[model samples]
Target: MSDTTTTSLLDAITVPAAEGRAIPDAATGETMGHAPVHDVEHLNRAVAAARAAQPAWAALGHAERSAILHRTADEIDAHAEELARIIAQEQGKPLNGPGARFEAGGCAAWIRNAADTALDPEVVFEAPGTRSELHYGPLGVVGAIGPWNWPAMIAIWQIAPALRMGNTVVSKPSEYTPLSVLAVAELMNRHLPEGVLTVVSGGRDVGEGIAAHPDIDKVMFTGSTKTGRAIVKSSAGNLARLTLEMGGNDPGIILPGTDVKAIAENLFWGVFINTGQTCAALKRLYVHDSQYEEVVRTLADMAASMPMGPGLDESSVLGPLSTKQQFDIVSSLVEDARSRGARIVTGGEAAPELGPHFYRATVVADIDDGARLVDEEQFGPAIPVIRYTDVDDAVARANASDQGLGASVWGSDVAEAVAVAQRIEAGTVWINQHGTLNPDVPFGGVKGSGYGMEFGREGLKAVSAPKVITV
Candidate 1:
């Protein structure tokens, strides 16, 4: 009944910081909590703790480590609701809907799945007198840098594999949404031995410190391509094994004969999930010229129908963009498209009536590949519907970007959609659906989207060093 949004639990449980900085709420623009601004010195200590713990932790061997991971997953599942609320409060996502609870559930599931996945020693070659075996050796310490969007899930994506692969972890979550991640780290640490997992909350410099830390043998990061590039540059000093999941200007192609009405809701959520803050969310939608208007009309109507508000509100389907800077970016891109003759099919302006950073789910029609909305990764709730005459040309346009994160093909005929999806240059290409990720499926990027994979056996390998032993 109160007009104010619910506060984060971390706001009450403030860990002392030498130089604390405030983090604002996404919905109200009110300062929700303060996190300690950790510097290189703080990072060094965390990394040292990781180093001190790695050998003993790794010495526990696969079974013991797996048990601990299972216990950690249990802890996560037990605290799901509380954790989800923390996520909603700090990260500006609906608590009950596919927001905080979904993300928290995902974190728990990823850990459980990681525990079940095996990284068994392989005997590569064997003769009567000689044998060679390949084993995955734990890298001393893994440095994880998680982004603000889906902080808990992405942190688990980074940490679960690292820990399961027998490495100690030191994580630095984006300062804006650090609380949920800090809480995750606490839960994980409780289930493990001391110094095995550490979280240092800070800004850009702390992330850079983690990347450049000599003690950290590997760095797993999920963020912007610009920040990914910076991490690559810094990690070069240590020659650390790096898995970077970066930017995506993902495309969704709607084939000529597809039923617009049938797929509208799926299309709407595919592009607009996480308020379009998703790295793999469809940013550009290529519709057949014949179906363009119908597709646009249906999607726009759906977008306009959804309620936008604070995460705590039960009626709200979409929450505010996680930060003011992101809101500005979305606004600027929409404005640029408008200036270039793109029609605002539905919502475009910020909903000040809702709260700060609450930009309505926007749909832009009559946009070309040249439009900013079509080309750039807006990373917000604004989608451009581009009309394409030829299917080949559409695929070409989709592959023309500097990014190749994810792509989707939609058609009434699943086989035809599959055929077209194969042509798009991206890490993962979907048929009928978009951005549906599985714990066992490997996902990453190509071209300027950055390299290396996450999830599955490959993800386990990314956090490990393969050593060949001959006897």
Candidate 2:
């Protein structure tokens, strides 16, 4: 889309307010638009509006709600390009590759899946005279707090199920990328009833209010572990149900004798997708000593070849870091690794020529477990490849982290890979891929990564309360 058209789209959704925050394009640092700065009072008003509208929304029954959800999905499909453009501008993800466009299409697909997934009341217990049926009913208003990494798509992941299960929603988008989410909410509201869905763009106060609001029946949040802990504490007043998808320092293991060349592309995308800002992206790799050199070489070559530039560029698959703060974090981690004698196989520097936030994709080898880059969730365009002599030891090291969001095993022997995957202590374990999600599969984290699941039937249930009736 042209700059004029992009500005027009943002203007259409931008709320006019005396108090607002300027939103900047992630690539160029240009002011894209403004988002109304909502406070706790605005959050309260939004919760009240959602609560007042929820009963009627629930009374519409599953069939009508499902129909409306399907229509909303269609609307999302209609405006997918516009939403993708907004995401590219605000979130620093390229329009091409597995970036803005992929996320936009995912929103529609997930909404449709939520609509079609069967969640009818089921008979849990049956006898001659006694019968019990379990039903899932709306839990009133749902508070959705989304992250900046996948702003629009993750909002849909929270909103779609909540709305599909017959609940009104009040969402708080991350401060860094509120425009992308606001634009999405604008498109969805075209089909949804007034007050049934609201997006309050603000800072930490608004997010805390959403978690602590008494009228809000549940909170769905995706962000950092530190912030997730704060939300957990905030939810204590009313004990609102929470589904938190938090920090993930996922690991990938390459078993002995694996074909490094065949899986190089998948591995590269797994570590570098969205410039590695993804919550579940593979942050560290444990390669067997036999193929460690080959794996490092393959990844470094791929990292050096991918173009890192502005998100709007047609040929740019890799884009800038979403924010300067994130860029600093990634840079610090890599610098620490370099100081500790880790090999910076390809890139270890920033690309200020492209933009203030651009960092070249990096591959670090000869890194061990104690280094900050190997231990922390780097969440940027960098991966540390550690060599291991034994498969069991590798599995043990991968499972040693506090975060257990996702893990992957790569090997020529399918059974061996599956065996290694089974031993990992993570919410989801992939055989040959990493961070690949499907609408039908359940996804979430364990331990410090956060609790509760999101996606498919479990996601539907997470937003609603269950009632058992024995007759």
Candidate 3:
């Protein structure tokens, strides 16, 4: 514990990291990308090791386990920049994306929230002959299915809470972005119990295996709604616990009287940051008639001006779309939108010259409500603007999708904006800013956007189970 680098702590464990090996590029095949390379077989072995080591880990007193969690938080902070770089490489996000900050911050937040905030069992009611109490307990092993867009950050999103509650984890990082997690898992194997947490790397089959495994007590997933449904149906057989943050067609409503330019910047960040790969990215925009043209024009100009290149490059404001599958999805969505009569005011195609998978930041305007681009979770670097006559109508249209994940309201009048925001069916509603996340606030979705919270006190409780005892 005295060694700040976690050096002595790591020295206590038996598993050594894969040494002197070259790392692979998550987005491309040419470079070390970011972190040390690992093998899929190695990841599988580590998780099995964790499963074996979990009973002892679970047997630790809550206080003892909590102290160790704090140590892990410190280790995360010490490696923030390095991990951020790895995340950028592995997830194909811009180095400036909140990955590094989110990784370190989320770990500390989850540890504190889970360990300090979760309720303890106490005698609540007693019969004349009996004493009754209720408390939370850890599930044996958690199977976490994380998306590539947020490899490191999302892993911590699940790991911190699960570990704090004394549950082991067998996390499946995106095949495209596994190293950042491998790094974390390696650190864990060295510092914590060998099987307290592990990473299992493969494709969707690995996900299926974890979901169907009898030993996995719960399944927490962050990805598309279609996949979420499959996970739900498959997991129902075992009556496993489920936490999902699925597809989001989040809407951003620009109400009248807002400074058109300022709100436009917020919209740009909402949709374009992380190259529009976030689950909460503003996929749909509803601007009041008074500000429709201005909002569209301003958003188009800003989006068009964004620099697209490699994320590790200093000048790049946007990076490649992570994997070739994402690149194709973005490209196809853009094409489908244009073919269905959406106006391509800014970017609408892949820029092959940028790299193997770089796509321009796209802003599609004049798209109707029925257009696939306007109503679906694009999950790409594109936002389609739709105009509405009334503020009520804007809210109505924004709420018109099956997915309700995150949304934002922009207006000079905070009271009116709040009233309008209250009507939208989403897990989080921002008054002005969009796509912002905080550790204290809960984040998740409603409807097909999936269920359960991932942060704050609600999140702390969700990853654990309550047990009642009567004597």
Candidate 4:
């Protein structure tokens, strides 16, 4: 393999944690690769390099820096296939699964948006000899601690904006899925200056190093709320600027008179797209009692239709969970839901017939608010459905969670659907649809899902040190 040894961080860098670790394909449970568990000593080296690079990168004019970022998009496009393969092997998501290509496309979009729309602070001049200006500048190097879910794509959400704003970065991708980030970093740096972007991989210790680094001017994290809170506490000493995109238990609602069969397709892919291991995947669903049966039947049919296999197989629609812990979590959630008197309408067990690390796309019905599956972020393929007598009740049930990451309200009636959508407490609410993202708009969440936005000018704006000049 072109990547198994050459671009391997183990061969490339020396670290204490790099001693020995096996990287296996999640789909087939085969040892496809290995990578170093980068230690703090290695992390410190990357941080120092980033600190040195940030100043020089920032010294470049905005247009020039933006141009470099734009070029990065082109480089990513050129290397999409290679990156995708690495992502599939290490992360165990399929080659066709949304990996390098999707991520590279997002990088293109974000950098372009940051360079264009996400502006420097506005400059205002009043008629009576009063001048006021707001300008943005990079915050030196940034520390990015990313999760394992969708490694390359989400990491780009941080790296793209930070780079466009001329902030060098030392990002630690989740140890559970480090190969994608390692390959992405290697490929990206080939098109960029050496120290502009660095990827260091390890477990929690490496993450701690990035969070507490004195040279790091800002910190961006995408992971669990528990970890995010700890990051904030650690960042207190340096008071480094922070942005956290945490977990979600996003709701999906179906109202009366809705075309159940038509939406079944969208809902299926939306929830189980990546084995339902998504931040915004439909965890808790509310259906109007009048149409509950139809919706349930439709969803079940759709889930059953999806093809599953080892990633290399063309027939595979769903792959395995990235790690053993996630598999256990999904399995336990199903066992709990079943024990709580929920109906397992479709799937509820590990598909040993499929292979290791594979879990069936589970669906549960007749769930209530108090059920563990109802109000929690499953982050798996299992979805629990609850029926409501009234639209208001459905809306109430949806908004009951402390997490406000994303939500979707569905119906044939646009007016009614949008109205219910307004009542949703999420940061991004879709009408008649589920997950979708672009570089132009701000993306983040409220409450426990964390604070601050990413993507577009909003993301670039976050990396800048806002200065207010008034005369």
Q: Best lDDT goes to which candidate?
A: 2
Worst 10 residues of 1 by lDDT: 1-10
Off by over 4 Å in 1: 1-13, 16-19, 126-131
Candidate 4 deviation (Cα RMSD): 2.8
Worst 10 residues of 2 by lDDT: 1-10
Candidate numbers, best TM-score first, in rank order? 2, 1, 4, 3
Q: Which stretches of candidate 4 lie over 4 Å from their true place?
A: 1-20, 97-101, 104-118
Q: What is the lDDT of residue 325 in candidate 4?
A: 89
lDDT (0 to 1) per candidate: 0.88, 0.91, 0.76, 0.79
Q: Which candidate would rank higher by TM-score, 3 or 4?
A: 4
Report the lDDT tens digits of candidate 2 across residue range 342-389: 999999999989999999999999999999999999999999999999
Candidate 1: tens digits of C-alpha lDDT, residues 1-471: 111135433543345554577767778877766776677788899889899999999999888888999999997887788788778878899886678899999998999888889878899999999999999988889999999999999999999988987899999999889888987876777679988888888778889888888888999889888999999899888999888899799999999999777777778888988889899899999999999999989999889998888987878789999998999999999999999999999998989998988999999999999888888899999999999999999999999999999999999999899888778899999877788899999999998888999999988988889999999
Q: Give me the overall lDDT of model 3.
A: 0.76
Q: Model 4, range 1-471, lDDT digits (tens) per residue? A: 135344543243322334646767777677656666679999899888988877788888688877877777776676677666666655656656453345546555655666665475687765578889888878899999988878888888888788888799898998777877776676567567878898887889988877888888899999999999999988888889999999799999998999886777778877886787778777888988999888888888777777776666655677778788888888888888899999999988888888887888877998789888786788887889889998888888888898999999889999999988999899899877787777777889998899998877678888888887887
| TM-scores for all predictions | 0.95, 0.97, 0.88, 0.94
- The TM-score obtained by model 3 is 0.88
lDDT of 2 at 120: 87
